[model samples]
Target: MSSSRSQSIQGTLPVIAALLGNGFIAVLKFVGFFISGSGAMLSEAIHSFADTANQALLMVGIRRSKKKATNEFSYGYGKERFLWALISACGIFFVGAGATIYQGINALIRPQHADVTYIVFTILAISFVIESGTLIVAYRELRKTGGKAKFKKILKNGDPATIAVLYEDGIAVLGVVVAFVSILLTELTGAYYWDAIGSIVIGLMLGVMAIILINKNRALLLGKAIPEEVKDRIIEILEEDPAIESVTDFRSAIMDVGKYRIKCEVEFNGNALAKEMFARGALREEFEEVRNDYQEFIKFCVDYIDRVPRLVGNHIDKIEKRIQEEYPEVVHIDIELN
Candidate 1:
């Protein structure tokens, strides 16, 4: 398969896995909640349901982001991924975290004993295993793109689909642990408020994670630039050409998950232009008399000026090709002469 196709598949795998896992786990959590009457279990059930829906939204983003460019959106639908991710973040905060917190506070005010403790423990253990598996899949995909970067850096710079799955699954696993501990503590001490406290903790964790995701997506939607190292590498490539004296300025923006639009201003070698004019038999000395004649000089100057842009354009093309070969993520490039 092509690299893009491979990347697309890799990106989709986490969402699909999360959707399936959360759907199954949500049902188990609901059943466990009904059996044990545990506040933590109920919160977990709601969290799993929210996770399933969030995975669906991510899948939509991934598919829509692949849409072909139209006249109205010449950059294509890449930013749709970030938009949908932001929506998903809000969903987690409101539906998952908000509901959980409210339920926890209500339970704390009116405590209720939880029975069937064994069932809740079993379900949480199973959920933990399943969530761990999903997290492993996300981490593997992240590693493919993240190289040696730390986990927080990966979450910041990685693709939205993978990042969403990683965050959701990681939080899910931690939620399961909290739920398990809360149930165990409540059963041992006969204090039902522990379960409510666990629910509150899980809600707070999800809230923090949602905020992080929201900020990352917002930055991308606002046209975050590619990494500084990447920009520097591109500049290095452009300056490698002898015809380019210096790269005066460089700027880039992320157009999609793995694509960018780069604009650069480069100063061309003055001697190179002089050499070209000499090679074309347009030496200034040859045109000395022509320069004295206003009409002839004007015509000659117009032709020379016309040829300069073409030569500069050809040099820019070479530089663009080199950058593209070095970094396939750069899909659009605009080079201006300085």
Candidate 2:
């Protein structure tokens, strides 16, 4: 399968798993919240609901990213994932985290008499089952992408949707614990406000995580650099080409929609025109080989030059200087072959 096709499948798989998992948890939590008047349980329910919605958005993004480039959209929709990822962050913060915190604060300020032990316990139990399933899917996906990295490294370098799912699993698991503690505390002290406080704390955490996801996606949308290893690999491939004498400079950019547009400047020894063509073709073929070997490569351009070809020189210093101004990369020279 093409690397792009494989990546597309990989991206969509996790999203499907997350959506299914979160959907089940949402239904269970909704029922649990209804049975138990615990404000914290209600907040947790909203969190799961928001996660379900976010996963749906992520799935849409992943699918949209597969659209081919068009005249109106030259770079294609690969970066659509980043855009939707940003929007998902907003929903998570506003709907999931915001609502939870709002309700929790209200409960704390105005204590209520609501028994929610059954709802809390049952929902938490179901959450474990659903979230675990989703987390397992995510881990499996990670392994395909090169296994799990350090937490900080993953946070810095991993895909936003993948990272967001991880956040969901971790937070959801912790929220369960927090809910259990709050329920026990309220039961022991008969202070319903403790449950509310627990809910509020969970909400705040979710909100913070959502913001972080947003920021992370935002950076990627703005065109972050490829990983160092990938950069080095690209360089190695270019250097290995026999036609390329030495690479003077290599630069790359991430255009909208996750397309990599690269430019390189290299110095080479004078060679026959036919040999140059052969070498260029060979180098491009090598590039294709490398791209196929690794999944991350997008696209590139290579310029091979033996020397700065002078158009006007010696007696025509002024003209040479003028030509240089117009085309900085070119040199000016005049040749007379009797």
Candidate 3:
């Protein structure tokens, strides 16, 4: 199969797994919350539900992006993935963060005697099982693509699949911690409000993370430039070519989740002009050469060249004076090599 198709399939698989696993967790947490009247458990249930919705949104975005380009939309709907992904982030903020905070506020205002032990233990145990299942699937998905890279660095750099899984796992772990702390506090002091406050804090934390994801994804969707290190790398490669004198500027954008769109401006020495003209079979050939050298790190390169003009006026004056004094072709003397 084609590489693009393989990438698409691989990208979609983890989202599917996340949606399924999150759906199961959502139900479990909701049931656990109701049985034990644990505010944190309820908050987590909503968080899972929101996450499921976000996964669904991601799937929809992915599917939309796969549609063929049409007359009205030349770039097609690939950017829809960004829009949907942003929506998912909003969902995380509103559903996950909002619900948790609301429960926390309620707990603070109207303190209730919570059976902290049951809520904490049940959610903690189930969170481990459910989160472990999802984490395993995520790891399996990521491992195929060359073992998971640095979690946040990859997510921030440009690996959407890894980003999604990392986001989910990271948030789930935080929720567990929040639940554990709140339950412990309540158990120790018998202040039921502490559990509610914990739920709220977890919500806020997830909400902030959601905003960061949204901002990062927003930049990509809006055609943000590539990292400076990548630009420097490209420039370094170009400078190594003897034909190239110097690079003026370079820029790139994320065309899709992982695909990149690149453009560059360069300057070359006078001697390189002839070879460059001879080499211009088509733009794609030049792009292919660069792509081969850089592999997946670089999608392609666009090049332009300029040749310095000889100053005939000044050279002619000097040559005429010297030639008159010496022997040469008297009639329309052809210029000799200097």
Candidate 4:
């Protein structure tokens, strides 16, 4: 398979894993909550359900992003990934965090004792194992793209689908741990309020994660630029050509995951053009004498100016070809002569 196709498959794999895992875990959590009457268990159930739906939404975004370009959207539907990711963030905030917090508060006001503590513990253990599996898959995928960067930086700059799955599963694991601790504390101290506190903490964690995702997707939708290192590499490539005097302006924007559009304005070396014209015999000392004759000089100047554009065009073509070969992520490149 091509690299892009491979990347697309990689992007979809974590979502698929999360969807399947969460679907199973959600049912288990619901059963645990019903049997134990634990607020934390109920909160975890809601969180799992939200994650399952979020994965589905991510799949939709991935599919839509692959749609062919139409006249209405000449840039294709790549940005759809960001749009759907944004929607997923909203879902986590409202459905996952908001509901959990509200339930925790209600439980706090009216304490309720949990029954069948052993069953809750069993379900939490199983959920942890399942969530850990998904988290492992996501972390591997992230490492493939992230290299040695910090986890937070990777999430900020990585593909939206990968980031979504990574964080979702990570939070699920942490939620399981919190739920287990809260149940243990409540059972030991007989406070019952500890379960509610766990629920509230889980909700607050989800809220923070959702906000981070929202900001990242928002920036992407607004046309975030490629990394500084990437921009510098492109500039270095452009400057490598002897015909280019200097790059006057350079701009870049992310068009999709691992895709970018770049625009640059470069000043051509006037001396290079003069040398080429001299070597081609289009510009000669004879032209200097022709300057004394207005019509002749006009004709000579026109012919020389016409050849300049052709040379410039050829040079621009070479530069563009080199850039595209060197940077496969650059989907579109616009080079202007200054």
Global lDDT of each candidate: 0.89, 0.71, 0.68, 0.89
Clashing pairs in 4: none
Cα deviation at 297, candidate 2, in Å, is 45
Worst 10 residues of 2 by lDDT: 329-338
Ranking by TM-score: 4, 1, 2, 3
- For 1-338, candidate 4 gives per-residue lDDT tens digits of 77667655657888889999999999999999999999999999999999999999999998899888899999888899999999999999999999999989999999998884688899999999999999999888888877798887777678898888988999999999999998889888989899999999999999999998989899999999998888998999988777788899999889888778999999878687667666888656767779679998888877777777787887788788888788777878899988
Q: Which residues of candidate 2, in runs, are more than 4 Å off? A: 147-155, 240-249, 254-259, 271-338
Error of 3 at 71 (Å): 3.3
Give, for candidate 3, the lowest lDDT window spanning 10 residues. Answer: 327-336
lDDT of 1: 0.89
For all predicted structures, in order, the TM-scores are 0.90, 0.75, 0.72, 0.90
lDDT of 2 by residue, 1-338 (tens): 75445655655667788888888888887787777777877887888889999999988887888788899987677778889999999999999999999999999888887676665686788798778778877766665664456656656766677777878877888887887788778888998989899899999999999999999888888877655665566556545544345657666544432245545565544353337455557556656656764443433321223222331122224433443443332221231211
> Runs in model 4 with CA error above 4 Å?
147-153, 273-307
Best by TM-score: 4
Q: Counting only residues 3 or more apart in sequence or on different chains, how many pairs clash (N, Cα, C under 3 Å) in candidate 2?
A: 8
lDDT for position 288 in model 1: 82
Tell me which of candidates 1 and 4 scores higher on TM-score.
4
